[model samples]
Target chain A: MKVRVHVTLKDGVLDPQGKAIHRALETLGFAGVRDARQGKVIDLELACADEAGAREQVDRMCRQLLANTVIEDYTVEFV
Target chain B: MKVRVHVTLKDGVLDPQGKAIHRALETLGFAGVRDARQGKVIDLELACADEAGAREQVDRMCRQLLANTVIEDYTVEFV
Candidate 1:
């Protein structure tokens, strides 16, 4: 099974990278862009037997190592 | 309107970050993990009027600044 995890900064967190990208876009003539937030995607291939098991393991992975739970939020998707 | 861009490394390209994460997962006891790939996600909030226009602008953003076209591929999504 394949799983995808998306990790994004929580609301109100400062994202300098996203700000920089937004600034770059404006400089490039894309003035319509109002806001930009950057995040991460992790794609995993598992030897697990079922979607439920994969989700459980991946969720644990996220909680333990894949995400900074303090400042970021993550969502897991089966692909 | 909102748009999302997912940027991922092309197949056969080496990803040291993903490897490190996989190793860490194994050390933490998640043995079912077989492979891991890492990518970036950019979420944009635009003042654009239509989804079509937002997609066009976001695609340009990906091609120009959000993604490296040579070793990475990006997908744009309307949200």
Candidate 2:
């Protein structure tokens, strides 16, 4: 089974990297972009084939390693 | 309009960051992980309201700024 995790900064947190991208886009003349935020996607290939078990395991993985819980939130899904 | 862009390393590319994650997961006692690959997600808030126009603009942004197309592949979607 394959699991995908999305880790994103919570709202109200400042994202400098996202700001940088927005600036670069504006510099490049791509108008109409009001904001941009950056996040991470982790794609995991698991030997285990059970869907429920994989989601649980991958959720644990996110809590333990993939995310900084104080500022970032994570969601796990099968992909 | 909201747009999301996913940028991922092409297959066969060396991803040291992903390798490190896998090693850490193994050490942390999570089993059945065959591989782990990391990618990026960028969320953009655009002033444009037309779906077709926004998609086209975001696609251009991906090719020009959001993704390093030589080693990365990108997908753009409306969110």
lDDT (C-alpha) at residue A47 in model 1: 95
lDDT of 1: 0.93
Q: Can you tell me the CAPRI class of model 2?
A: high
In model 1, the runs with Cα more than 4 Å from the true position are: none
Task: List chain B TM-scores, each candidate.
Answer: 0.96, 0.95
Q: What's the true lDDT of residue A61 in model 2?
A: 90
Per-residue lDDT of candidate 1, residues B6-26 (tens digit): 999999999999999889999
Highest-DockQ candidate: 1
Candidate 2 reaches a DockQ of 0.91
Residue range with the least summed lDDT across 10 consecutive positions in model 2 chain A: A50-59
- Native contact fraction, candidates in order: 0.96, 0.90
Off by over 4 Å in 2: none
DockQ for each numbered candidate: 0.94, 0.91
Error of 1 at A58 (Å): 0.9
